[model samples]
Target: MTYRPATAAVPDLGVLTLGVEEEYLLLDPDTGENLAVADQVLTTLRGPAREQSRQEFRHSMVEMVTPVCADLTELRDNLVALRRSAAEAAAAAGARLVAIGATPIAEPHRSVPDKPRYHAMSRRYGPVAHDPAVCGCHVHVGLPDRELAVQVCNHLRVWLPVVQALTTNSPLHDGRDTGHASWRSMQLERWPSIGPTPHFESAADYDRTVDELIAAGIMLDAAMVYWYARPSAAYPTVEVRVGDVCPEVDDAVLVAALSRALVATLADDVRVGVLAPAIRDCLVSAAHWRAAHDGLDGELIDLRRGGTRPAWVLVNELFATVTPALARHGDLEYVRTQLDRLRDEGTGATRQRRILERTGDVHAVLDDLAARSRAG
Candidate 1:
């Protein structure tokens, strides 16, 4: 079934401002190998782009954050500019900025930056810290109160797998198809606290759980909670950290629009005292694994019902659920068109596999990713 936009009048546009944080890997343009020159690349950025960009835990990776955007159009423009500036900086530093979710070509040893926190993580986590050079897209929706953010997380839990399925960009790792759409998601499972956020009694309960994890040495700090959706430790937003960093600008914009609309809808539910669904955590985790394995190319667990359904069907349901919010934010038609485009071209994983199947070369996949990454 097709998604229909809501007929409600648009609401005030300032309710839930949104922003995006995307992490990327630098690669040798000719060899398609990971390059450990993030520092050099950062030096090449100027003005606002440089301010929004920072080095990630791994020396081979960099992250670009968009300023808080009031609407999807502003967010898209910021993302396009950020990607252009980042690609230019990487080129200046003798590398290509590719937005694939994980490093396709493996390196013998990946280096951590010289920061104390990064070094401590490397020393403590050992192979877990060193092995995977994965990246993800984090969407932050404005919510000032921690209690409301926690409630919103509960509302968001059921749809996390669907979100992951929509943005599965990391199919290949170490120059091989890992038999999974988002290998980056699998790689994160090794971490201590990384999955769907649990149902919380209140914001206090959430804080206590985080404190307990830290006290038990399961997490380094609040920032390391790493749940798929959580009250941001650094910001007043509910940060949804489920999706792989999308390959194309349109994909990222689609994710941002859906995420903001979802948050706005769920927050309204919270205001009206709608209870969160009581799905089993194990089931949610299983659904996540299924999404990581198949992306949108196969069926996904239908949480509302008892059986699995095609991934696109579930995505349609999500759009239906959040239609009013989409309409309020002036994103209904844009999201509709983008969803059609996504279905036509396929998810990033599908595109990557298609390139590999046709060309029989991993470098060709990287070449396409670099070109798309720079494209507006």
Candidate 2:
């Protein structure tokens, strides 16, 4: 069961085409419980136009696959259309499709999708794969060859935590405010292959390590190498698989644009042999921890500065780092406007906490997230 890209050859790798893939949980609108009805939602979405909405490993979750978009505007438009289709289907199934990274309600133990790989995961990993309803956003940036792509991932290791900081949408897990911005990432960390990957010297080194893992039965296949960023198994692009799934479509646009710009900047650096200084995994992990624990409102470990700074300051530095790349796509103003709005209004993570504070009801957070998602 090998999956390949829908279109193999990309035009002009210099332009950096991109595709955005997002996973989401379906919820009962009233109680905010994860409804095991993704199949029903996907069934309602059936037809030539609705192929982008598909099943995930969990029965309560669905994935949205966007077309290979050229730029941010097209990405936003396609995401809006896809979300509209998914919302209608979910509504028809007596559920609301949420773009949240993790469900707030205490998740009822539910069945995994009836797939051989999923069944095997449940059998082997038990609760981690079957416990909570979690979702993520994956952004694929065009990189023609595996070597450049692997290099891009290696160079990206240092800043991935900062990017993840801006999109921490899963603060509450299993009905408790977990005191962290993205508990979905914590659940993800349960997997052995999950989290940041070490630097690989070359594409062969990357593939060879994966081969060893598969041969040793540590991973089922090449697709199971769950690095924060890696060469896509099915696409001629490097996929960044971190970040909690965002509620608003525009937030998704912001993440995608920033991520693409970051990757592009790194790819350029790789070509010039001017890679950023590599921070060891310990510091990288600590920076990520601070990012998740405090999100934007609190301080974060500034790896470049070797000290802690407010996340907003760190995030601003991130934009500065990739300013040239964002400008290349004429997305500087758009990114600036969107990121400013995200900072002012706060991400879904901060907003989720505010909602809980205001209503004193965890369910209100879900309702707000669902309404915001469905509205877009």
Using Cα atoms with residue i matched to residue i, what is each candidate's TM-score against the true structure?
0.95, 0.94
lDDT of 1 by residue, 42-96 (tens): 9989999999998898878899999999988899899999999999999998999
- Enumerate clash totals for all models, in the order shown: 0, 0
Scanning candidate 1 in windows of ten residues, the lowest lDDT window is 1-10
Each prediction's whole-model lDDT (CA): 0.89, 0.83
Candidate 1 residue-wise lDDT at 163? 94
Q: Where does candidate 1 stray beyond 4 Å?
A: 1-14
How does model 1 score by TM-score?
Answer: 0.95
lDDT of 2: 0.83
